[model samples]
Target: MKSPSPGRSSAVRSMRSAPFFTPIRVVFSFAGPSARRPLSFFSPTIRPSAWRGRPWKALRLVPLLSQNFKAEVVAVLMLILFFSWCYCSYVLGCWRLNIALSWFWWRHLDAGLHAVMHGDFRTRHDIQAGLFWIYSLLSHRAMEYYYGARELKGNGMSKHWWHHIYPNDPGRDPDWSTMTGVAWVRRHTSAQWHPCHQWQCWYWLPVSMFLEPLFELIQVACALLEAVASLLEPPMNGPYVSRWAHVLGFLCEVLFNPGFQLVAFGVQPFWKALGVLLLARATSRLLLYPFSEVQHYMPEHILNREAADDSAEWVIGQLLCTANLEFRNRWAWLMDFLMFHGDSHQIEHHLWPAMSFVQYTKASQVVRATCARLRLPYYTVGYFEGYQKICEQVKEHRKPPPRPKRPRSPGEEPSPSESSSTRTRRRTRGS
Candidate 1:
């Protein structure tokens, strides 16, 4: 077989990288903030502007979204990169980069450095997040099987093992943790639950879409910084990386990161490189943002914060606190093929992390039916409905249901159904 071309490999890598949108999706979402309007490519009207200034306005955009298949395809791919660059802030004047979240991360990382000096933390929080990886992988098992880093059993405390082992413990279950944003809840949060949490419903979707791309960037930066910091730590604390090894690892960090790696994936021209990386990274991140925050971030997940630890067996714990979705959809295989698989069947993935994407459907069915037989919660919600539920929960979070009073008279105690009604009324009043 002929060797795969660099561009072909790059295309695959870019798709696998988180962050993207189809060119069509971008055009529709391109209305200005002030005159907000969705794209109308599907509409007979070519121009979707509220101003109705130029009916031909969309004609200029037509080359980018043509009727011709190959041209349209190319245009769409370019738009993904263009918009990704716009959102990722690789170029300015496209869109705002690092809005509400950039400051948050800045402060968070600053506090981390401060902790390295004082404030009860042993190491910088930034470094702590990384646990000091010279280079990281999407799956550490891939690292072990292919790269022969067999010592990294689940990458030793940084990977999903902690989440599987600890489930929903705020400290250990990485899935059940929050890195930043307002600290809510009286128990686990650094800040008291604020009235503002009610407005999260309003802001989270748009803000998360904007802020999510930076999340991976910030995470990688911290990881690399910790790796650098590790080099300075005592040998007992740091991995023994020789000078040559350090150089190689540093290159790997830059080249292996999804963003930079996408850029370097192909032997294409500069613009093509940018476009490819832009398409894959931005589209992946954009589609991922809405669902990503909702995962393990529903209101019930937060209410469980009263407990510091969990005792459920690992499998059951995953079923209890984690959620699943109706992944048996048209796009399930496409998502799987693109390498961001099984998230729609998140519980199944956790239960069998290394299972092939092709096998996930059967595995999911087995797990779901088994969990149902055992009377465990094995939720499988539609994609849009799942997001809708999460949005509703965010709005309702501030107003918890009122507690029922004990019976004073023989018949004073509310029955189970009555208690539910009374609770509903209180919740309504609180809202």
Candidate 2:
């Protein structure tokens, strides 16, 4: 076989260096208000001193459903860099770079979606819809894998807003159990409980870690089917179907889909690179989900519609449903940083969804102090403690729920069925 091109090798090497360089670059560019600089590129162009002691003011600083255009553009460029690395590594058979880049891809998976969620970069004339249309093509690689291809008007923002509206309601929350595997193994709500879930606490952590790649594959297949179906039907257009539409839809869904570009699979080197990709996907989820998943649906928050307090004040309801991850050490903070602080200060994020991640540090302080003063539940558990608590919650609900006792008037005799059962129990005990 001819040796791989030297230029390709050099490009792969350069791409591999991104894992090291990007974080440092991102740290400097996205620096928090506490940094010596006036303000960082990633934050909104506001005075650094304006960030202190005024979380409510910070909320007013950014309008609802708005984002910093330039900062979000830079974030998108970072996403593209990581995505390009994944593509090149796969095509060029650079397994090491491919494996390394997969983690970067998974780490930024939420960040990518959130960037799009936060802003449209002030685009014009339905361009934001087109942007989502394009992102919907690639979003399956993220944790919100299924339903990645949403209707233009009904894209992630709508879906996310729906989640906020119903946070942990049993049936209404779209994110209740997006991962089908977790839905089976653990009950995020009492309604989700099954007898089989009893064993989940023991095995779920290990087993679900490897299932991420499997979930990815399933999501890719689902996206392909959806793409083909959408093309054939061509929503809102006339119902006249053509034969060429069928052929082109099949080709695009199988061949051109960003999630599963199949051209390199015929090559031997692709298999090695694929293994790394799968491993990276699995490993990243293994590390990331414990931090991310524990943010909501804890034991105290296992609410169904009937039991949920829909009438509660908005901020209190948000606080009740969302929990923040606390980092006690530098290592934990590093992990939080890698997660884009999405899990840390989650309570603040839920309360003020439009605030930039860089603004979270100051916002969290204010939120924490106010929660303390008001004596509201401010759940900020250490990373491992949060993980274990969520697992314990799963275990606690594994058994069947205890039967509610029948109420009776004073000195009332048992009903016929109840008396017969009581006699049978007496006879069995005597025997």
Give each model a TM-score.
0.45, 0.62
lDDT of 1 by residue, 221-291 (tens): 67667656656767775345432244344455454333544324344456654554444455544454435
TM-score of 1: 0.45
Give the poorly placed runs of model 1, Cα more than 4 Å off: 1-159, 179-202, 215-247, 260-283, 301-315, 337-341, 352-357, 372-375, 397-431
Q: Using lDDT as the measure, which candidate wins?
A: 2
Q: What would the per-residue lDDT of candidate 2 be over residues 24-90, giving only the tens digit for each residue?
A: 1221222222112211211323223323444434343433322345434545565567556645764
Tell me how candidate 2 scores on lDDT: 0.51
RMSD of 2: 13.3
- Taken over the whole model, the C-alpha lDDT of each candidate is 0.40, 0.51
